[model samples]
Target: QITALDSDTNVHVYAASKWKTIELTSQMNVSTKTPYSNGIKFTWQQSYERGNQYCLAISAWRPFTSLCQARAADNYISGSTEATNHRRPAVVLMGCTDHHSYTLPERPHVIVHVAVWTRQGGPPLARAVVRPFKKPRVPRLQPGQLLTLEPSSGGRALARLRLRRGAKRLFVVAVACGANLKLQILSSDGSRVASVAGGQGALHLKLRQNQPSALKMVMTTNPPGAARTLLLAASTSAKGLPLPRLPRNTVVSTIKASCNNVTLQWKSASGNPNYCIMLQEDFNPGGHHIRALAQCDWEDVLQHPVGYLISQCNPGAMKARRQRYLVGHLLPAHAYIATILVQHPITRHVLALKPTYFKTKEDCSL
Candidate 1:
């Protein structure tokens, strides 16, 4: 099952069994001894230009009541990861089952299904492959210990660590260079505990534990075989650690509005050096717009923003003050919401500021 929270904090639950009927642009197969025996790797090369964006979805065939699927994009930047200007091909690795346990019933073979399409609505041009391999030995992680992995082209790595009893929280910090990084944490039963995607970022994971438990960490890089560096560290506490924080007093006020553009101004508190502004049409139910904005995060806002800009907060200046920005090429007389995001100078963590509401002017010439 998949559960998601919208901007209004509405809960959404999705069944895992419905993936069997979804149409796909492409599909492939892989063999495995048992449902939990080996890991399956999928690689695809994008035939389109690097600037174009595409969505990639992967799922395994399940004859029973449910299916396991994972989705990714070529240009996806998680809230925990810093946004980058470079683009890379999409790559992913999947185990036989979603559960962390190896006690599942055995299966002779597994079929893998892949779907690739452009964001603008057509089938994408790409080449893909599917293969199976033995699970590599994972290194045990000691408390507060940091580990680094450098994988060559078309390679993968794993690490194992035990979450001590009475420790109900886990924090993971990952830094990647030269390739897009994907991280997954799985329990001993093969069930996923938590996962995050980014080129570089940190994530906090919470799990209730009554006794000591073991976990497996999986890291993969995009472009299948691109050589990359991944620095991983795990701990239980966040006190005194340099992490991302939301900028305070981030409120946007409209300076000017035209038929197709809007000028906005907002003040930044001290220490906020960079900002990302996103504008999207307001299509939510009436009266819930502000509530939605108040509850949403960077990931939710970036999903379908119509206009986006990243700029220095106060370029060449050392003091905190107001900054002006313009979001152009919008529809006339359309209601929209603008959200501000602040990036930390050291951790590269991105957090959302309070969102502002506005509307474009009606076209006078009509």
Candidate 2:
């Protein structure tokens, strides 16, 4: 019987007195200290009529490896004839006497995550992660540099290389960069599967994603730097998704900023009903900072009892400046970044402008 003991039952007291002459038998109850330094005592009181015999075994069992409870296996053994089956055999020990443990061999499981980038593809190029179940280290991406088989879910991005499903897997080609960069691929467990080579061109890495795999990209920095973007794209439909229409007559004009407050001024396009101005600071040449300081918006043609201001330039149209709003305060000396965005009043199509730049006084800076 597994009896739970409290502090009142001194471990040393029971071992010193009642259990001093324990004659263990198969019928003798075995009391353990909860496998650690428990102060509780196990009173294996022996009856004079019964002989004592006990079978005590100390063994460890792992449903999953690691405290994270995420590792499927511990190593990458060569693929055997049974690679098709996902369940990798586990190593277990029997009759363990002293603190039993098991050492997992390399490549214990056959699960892999495959990231593919396709270009006029035949067979999808593959780069198997050298180490499975670990996070991959991603290097700083140059303006035009690309990596083969990048993992991403689709979204609007400038100069982004999209991945396509090839005959066997998805494929992506990295854009070439001239300088040496370091990249590491990690699996779910904190292990490295692949590392960057010293070549200027792009290198391909493959993962087998027959099953769902969760991975993250990590990079080491020489000099301190802010967080960079990691691309993850969702599968696009068979017929290509409609591309956003190119914006025309993109203009940059001045806006007003008082302390932390900002007011933007802009002219509407022929059929523009609503507009969005995304603000991002272009102070640093190597990086772009995105943060909204304030926004001004209004609908075309008065709809409700809300006080409406008509545009002087266009009849029956609401003025742009009349819709201005003060969002929140900015830090003193911080720059105010602005962009002009316009959308078709009826079509709801968005027209993004080239990012604009400005600065706030030190009193209103963040």
Candidate 3:
């Protein structure tokens, strides 16, 4: 029998003097070290019974191919299929998390899309990751620089685009060949700004920058497989050039910083009073290559839960000033970045404020 661990007494240990030498052969005395905690120690014991053997195997997967939230230990392989079924796909997402932090983790709804496909005689397609999409920080368009947009023909029933500029007028013109196409210009929070539904003819819509910094576009075509074209063109006037196109009181005016707390001050947003505060470590501002992966999230970067603090501005109303929030559980001698998410009280639209960062001193306490 095979015995391991010092406490195991399943088999008795033998001494060199107790061994019997073959008929006429001579045997030398052998001694081995006893098993201990530090290193692998083996003892030479003679027994007539054979026991089970133990072994280990190593595996290596493609970089970033491993899922962060695997429920169990199992190996999966993708075969030659153009697309995998979403209901029972090879990769399943559970949630986002930090690196095994002891604190409570935030559960963000991260939607997974795009399936990795395989071909018969061609090269394999690159894997695509699906993560929550954020609004891009686009600069204002220059004078005489016309913005043009043309949609693609695909199976998607809805498409989204964001336009960020301070300009005089924005226009969207759509030409439907024969299908019923619907166009909706929405605010950041999925609120409708301008909508048009029709059978044919050119639908022209205009928007201004002084209204909202960014807008979302949603297009739907009826009869499923009808052909359609959408053109988005924008222009700026010299009269509205000096001031930003966004409405007044749309962003936080200033941020008050302290040793262990921060106060975000802002003029009452014109339409909405609901707001949110989000904080995550911004140690690597210029390098965001790693975070582009769907698995990497605020928790992973912050080494803790995503400090997403949500609160209303005022009871029944939406106004709060000098809002002070205690920045707790921050690492000493570290830098962190914070941002604000405000929703329009009336239109139910949303907007994000400028991001700000602060550094903590040693032994910082709230």
lDDT of each: 0.52, 0.32, 0.39
Ranking by TM-score: 1, 3, 2
Best prediction by lDDT: 1
Q: What are the runs in model 3 whose C-alpha is more than 4 Å off? A: 1-256, 285-326, 346-349, 363-366
User: What is the per-residue lDDT of model 3 for residues 140-230, given as tens digits with 9 covering 90 to 100?
Assistant: 3333232223334541133344444554466554433334566777777777778876543224455654545556656565544454443
How many collisions between residues are there in candidate 1? 9
Cand. 3 TM to true fold = 0.27
What TM-score does each of the candidates earn?
Answer: 0.31, 0.23, 0.27
C-alpha-based local distance difference test score of model 2 = 0.32
Best-to-worst lDDT order: 1, 3, 2
RMSD in Å for model 3: 25.6
lDDT of 2 by residue, 160-212 (tens): 22233332232222212122224454545757645443232222333444312
Give lDDT tens digits, candidate 1, residues 106-170: 33144434444443434432323333333445677665665767665564667888876678766
Q: Judge candidate 3 against the unseen true structure and give its global Cα lDDT, from 0 to 1.
A: 0.39
Clashes of each: 9, 67, 4
Query: Which stretch of 10 consecutive residues in model 1 shows the poorest summed lDDT?
Result: 62-71
Off by over 4 Å in 1: 1-137, 199-212, 240-366
